[model samples]
Target: MAEITVDLIKELRERTGIGMGDCKKALVAAGGDIETAITNLRKAGMASAVKKEGRATNEGQIGFFEAKDCIALVEVNAETDFVVKNDRFQQFLTHVAEQAADTKPESLEAFLKQSYAKEKGMTVDEYRASIVQTIGENIQVKRLSIFPKKANHSYGIYTHLGGKICVVVDLEGASDEEKLAKDIAMHVAAASPLYVNAEQVPESVIEHEKEIVKSQIAGKPENVKDKIISGKIQAYCKENCLVEQPYIRDDKLTVAQFVAAKGKEEGKNLKVVSFIRWDVGQ
Candidate 1:
């Protein structure tokens, strides 16, 4: 058997544009012959898939998975909306989301190296490459996020526009109120709040808002400027903070007040801990 050296693997990778692991394996299987390895890769369609890798991937869907211990959201991108609607692409996205939820990989690179859950004898990235070859488009597992379940914490998940937009809200309370949590998640999807509350807003961000407010009220009296700035900041928080924003279902009550009212009915205290909102191509 021929020894498969680093240089040989590198040459194969340079020729194929495939992953190092795949390149090395191909080299070894071909007895360290770069031409033979390239032939094998081409026969398997991996080499051809490399041609589409550089294409723009601005259309795709978000995949959501919920497990007993954690929840996951994955954004997979493709070159066209037509590919996004393909059955195989949708299946691959679902499998990737489930993998993220099950494995809780710390990073996208780690996730790609994981074994594909629905397929045998293949890494996630390998499966993705095969899909690209089949679909004849650039496909990418863009990003993923996992949220671990916490005691006394319930999650509200809402998917909008058939997963073009997805939101997950973590709520802390004594009892699980799924409907309330989901309502908050829906509010998050619709309102697009950056923070859970006013206090969560960074001081730098507040200062920047103040600077904008000051410039807008430049001609105002000096004594009234401070009060006006304070008012403007307060309004900014109300609009940008999830809890402070008016509830989408009932504009009369702020999101925080709505949660509090629900808590009162449930005989427990409730608060929004954090949330994640994802928009496709964003």
Candidate 2:
């Protein structure tokens, strides 16, 4: 057997964070080769597909950006929240967000594959690897979103806790009241709007709502079916439309009236095109 020194055990333990005894055993098994031992330990640690590097990067920060008509958000995850706040990780996230804003990739996967502008030396994954080595833990690029501009539109973006949560909104047209767009975006971050407009409500959700309404009105006579249908449709419209939502600031005027009032005052028609919201856990 090769010599198993205390130094070997300590080094392996520090590298893998596995138990000291386990690290020592791995070293001996690898015939005092630290590299071989680390590989073996890492392989054993790979309990799940994602665990190969460590774990699903359950911790990280969100990154956000906006430029006139375009906006983007990215989530860069690391093994720990401590690393999430590290200057390097934060800078990396900013770089990734900027890259996301700059690239008009046809798809999210395509976006990840694109060379990250901030890291000239490597592709996105390779940059992540460099960070992982420096940080001594697994890091992952989770997901991102990029919004394309619409004619005459402006984008509003919100970031909380350096990216614990993010929200972006696209106003179909610009207004002198730019603050309103931000307010709307903040509301989305707080309230978590699922659909931009009633028309965008998924058919599955609508059908599910209809079923629930139908069940509730089941005991009613068949003669009132039309009335029930009409009432349910009205409820659906009121519940699903962001325009009909109670204004977050005032809680009095519906979102439609809120926008309309501002539009009139500004002498512009501001329609909402779409929005995106992201939170760490979600």
Candidate 3:
């Protein structure tokens, strides 16, 4: 039997775009013959996924999974909307989300290398490769997020438009907890606010908005300009900050004001601790 060196595995993986583990297995099975290994990978349908890796993946679905103390969000992308509806694709998303919910890996790279939750012996990357083979389309797990609940916080998630947009909100203390958290998630899905609060807005973004506002009022005096710019900045913050934005359910009250009112009534802290919004392909 020929020795299957690391060089052989590397070459096979480069040629086939199959995972390192599968490439090594193919090489060993083929007695270290690169051509034979390639043939074996092709026969197993694993090689097709590599070729399709460059295809544009603008359509897909967002999956949510929650356990007793952890919540996860996963976005998997495919080349077309038709594939999004495929049971295989949906199953793959579920598997990925479950893995995310279970492991809570710090990064996507780590998640890819972590052991798959449902498939006992394979890594997530390997499982994804198998699905790519089965689906006959390039499938990419674009992002995975895991948020473990804090002792003082409760979480809520909302998916709208069949997973086109998903929102996850973390709130301080559990006061009117379920309804408040859910309504906040719904507001995030609809309004698409960019930051949790004014503090989260970047200084560079504020400066950019200031420049645009200044340009719009080019002829104004310096003092008047300063006042106008300050007001514009406040308005911008209100528009972009989740807590400051007018609540979708009732525009008369800002989200922060609504939460504060509810908190006072319920006798608990109700601050928006943090949130994440995922819009497919964005």
lDDT, candidate 1, 34-126, per-residue tens: 888899999888899997898999998999999999999999999989999999999999889998998999999999988898988888988
> Candidate 3's residue-wise lDDT over 18-130, tens digit each?
77887888888898889998987787667887888888999999999988778999999999999999998898898889878878889999999888878888788778878
Q: How do the predictions measure up, each by TM-score?
A: 0.94, 0.75, 0.91
RMSD of each: 1.7, 8.1, 2.2
**Pairs with backbone N, CA or C atoms under 3 Å apart (clashes), candidate 3:** none
Cα error, residue 154 of model 1, in Å, equals 1.7
Name the regions of candidate 1 deviating beyond 4 angstroms.
1-8
The superposed Cα distance between candidate 2 and the true structure at residue 51, in angstroms, equals: 6.7
True-vs-predicted CA distance for residue 49, candidate 3, Å: 2.1
For residue 58, what is the lDDT in candidate 1? 94
Clashes of 1: 0
Residue 179 displacement in candidate 2 (angstroms): 1.8
| Model 2 poorest 10 in a row by lDDT | 43-52
Each candidate structure's count of clashing pairs: 0, 0, 0
